[model samples]
Target: MKQPLLTTDFLDRAVDLFADDVGIVAEDGTEYTYGEVGDRVNRLSNALRERGVEKGDRVALLSKNSHYFIETLYATTQLGALFVPLNFRLQPEEYDYLVGDSDPDVFITDAEHAGTVTHLQDEGGVDEWICYDADDAEAGQWDDYEAVLEAASPDQPERPDISEDDDATILYTSGTTGDPKGVVHTHRTQHYHAMVHAHHVEFEDDDVLLWTSPMFHINGWGHIYGLTGIGGKHVIVRDFDPQTVFERIVEHDVSFLGGAPTVLNFLLEHNEEHDVETTGANPVRVETAASPPPKRTIRRTEDELGWRIIHAYGATETGPLITTSNSPRRIQDGDKYDIVNKPGFATINTEVRVVDEDGNDVPCDDETKGEVIARGNQILDRYWNKPEATEEAFTDRVEGWFHTGDIATMDANKMLTIVDRKKDVIISGGENISSIEVQDVLYDHPDVRLAAVIGVPHEKWGETPKALVVPHDGADLTEEEIIEFTRDRLAHYKCPTSVEFREDLPQTSTGKIQKFELREDYWNDDEDRRVN
Candidate 1:
């Protein structure tokens, strides 16, 4: 009665019970049932084995949101191989660095990025190359993805004896500071996250999830596992097009999905041009992470769009679901804006705390800020190859809790509100100011579309808060007007001293604004760049 928990159990359950149900609807409008998808996973596993990918070998994939990505995840894990999903937006040199670091045995990519891999095949250190949507003539040493699947038998391969502690995947962080670190997760850790997510979001077998977020980002925040485990249908879109997303929700009857606040903003903007009913008998529920949406955006999303919004907070090391704002009663009785604004309570079986510099619990007076730390079965065990980084991440200020490097405050109800990244906090005239607080005020402006706040080198104050804003499509917003707008709401020190208009802000693949990039030009002349 003591069977080990494994990720393969999710696919096995779906195959055994929901085989006849539609499991995936690709962007090409082709549908595949659970039974058919299961066959493909088996065939892919067999093909990898034939290619000499043994247990513990790293199988890396670089592709967009597609059915092939899902198959690769199950196939790689089924054979007890560690899956490494790479960000497609990275440069060739960045890809070279990751491939070199992870030491993947097989590197797989789609046609759009085949050239990048082909150029790196000489020095990428990968043993095998697999290309999807590649012509046989163009694929030199690379194996065609479809051809390999076509040649392999559909029989399920013999799975290796995998333990719950076995490494299931190595997800690379965004590398805001320097080179990306590989955050390794065990089968049990991921399984726990999937179970918690399924329970928190109340995912049912009838739920249809749209793939708005890339599958590469924490396995689309674990929906690839959590949603699939429930035998829910997945509608895969190649990319996030506001109009296309609205169309898919209606076309596939999508019940749930996840994205960042930026994606939600895009959908809201799209609705201004076209009419789309997001709420009805089956109102679409969206799970948003990254930065918390401004209170105005949250209210508009629910009242105007009619879609329920769930806010969550976590990092790559925390299985990406440490806390979620998912209380039905709170949303029903309390102010919806206030409830959804907070990151909500710690997830089931997870412990989240805000600790001071000495590792003591911060007062839950709702105004005191401290470093957010988490400990649970779902937290990552270590970095892949960096022992020093691994040690520092876990034992820096606390013994067991993973230091999240985020500053947050917990309310009396235990709802957590993130203030800012520890490194992004602006210090002006010896006073600390949260960049998120300033950006939230800027987001309230009717002319602003997306905004980022960074601390720039100042002669007198040492460092001052500067704002970079992207205005609405047709709004001709002036810097003086934008500065006055924020000055009216927030404290004078927290308001931006200057404002710069841009067409768009630099963002990571997950829709997080890269503040470091915004600060680069401003702090270039200074030898000692004050990140704080």
Candidate 2:
């Protein structure tokens, strides 16, 4: 008599109970009711089925924030196919490995990024190519998305009988030292995570969500499922301009939006400059994650904008919403900013622990910094096609628990305050830039002999990657040249903001570089730890 937990259940309930309600607002301000959204999903699913997408097949999407992201997610998962959403900011070359690794049969993208993967489609990795606004697309032989949907039958697709444990999505996360690894989540994992996250944020049917966060980022922090299931409205924002965000919040009466601390900083700047209205008919609450914001940022966002801030912590491997600072009872006990500033205890039915190098629990005096570990239904099932990497992740510090590689301190109340990154991954502006990845790129420079990358404090972004290099003898490598080299090869955001010339990099006798020592100059002191 038990019902299976499925990701499609969210959309199914929306169409069944809230068909007449507006479910999504497109990037261009067009509204789509749940009925229309369901019709489009059915058409897309049928079209993909006709074109050879089947159970266990992968359907990849490359786009920014849009209604089509939600459509594609349900369409693919409903048919027992795996949904793969790529980071749209990635370069053409950067996608080569992701495409090769995922090996999707169908690839979809927006007109802006259609041409980026033209060569990938031609190489036979993908069987079908569909692009939104195909008339303006630069890629050849791509079919229009609307045309494909119109040609297919607008009926419920014949779904293959699937189980909860079946793989549902593949999200790629940056590996500190090598190629990006795919984090795979099953239907039950996403479904349960959405439910737990919905309760933590206290989502209601009448709530309105502004899609400020990119939909590709952990499925917009899993709001695409939680908000939709609760019969809330989604207002899309394709390009996150500060002015546009404030306007949308005022116009749509947006009750909730996910903005990292860096994004909140931008909004604070714009609000101060223009003196714009921050909210509409509804009180606004923003969910911030990625890297923890500085105390100054939290104070300004609350004092100036007058919006409630819910800070969270987790990686793409975790549910990305496993921990949140949104305790109503605790707010009455202490100052509001002090309570919401740190990532509070784990969500309902989730277990989080801070463990020492020996896998023992650290004293929760808010002083002992240890690696964060978690276990929950929301965690990723496995890393796609990388069994060794998956095993290492779960067994590195504690056996059977997912080692998060994030260094944090827990309070007496089990609240977690992140201090640094153990793996050297730089979380700048809500995007994970692998310090090793940048170092690898720097090593390719002919003038560079020894290279290291570390996150340094930034006024705008939470922090940014900075490169330190020891040039070869008599090789005059300027800072501009080092920065320009990475810009040409990597995404501009992933490039180093500044470079430093050094005579030698501190290394152990075993030739391993000590980045923590190099980070001391950029970071203030022991009290001011690196908030990766």
lDDT of each: 0.88, 0.86
What's each prediction's TM-score? 0.97, 0.82
Candidate 1 accuracy as TM-score: 0.97
Give the per-residue Cα lDDT of candidate 2 at 446.
56
Positional deviation of residue 371's Cα in model 1 after best superposition, in angstroms: 0.4
Candidate 2: Cα lDDT at 317: 91
lDDT tens digits, residues 1-532, model 2?
9888999999999999999999999989999999999999999999999999999999999998999999999999999999999988767998999999999999999899988888786688689999999999865788999999999987998899989999999998753346889999999999999999998888999999998888887888889999999999999999989999999999999999988655776687678779999999999888888766656667888889989888888888997778989988988988777778798899999999999999999999998878899999999999999999999999998889999888888998899988667757677889877675577577667566677889888878888999989886679889999999999989999999999999887653212356767877887654244322
lDDT of 1: 0.88
In candidate 2, which residue pairs clash?
Answer: none
Candidate 1 error regions (>4 Å): 136-140, 277-281, 526-532
Q: List candidate 2 stretches off by more than 4 Å.
A: 424-532
Clashing pairs in model 1?
none
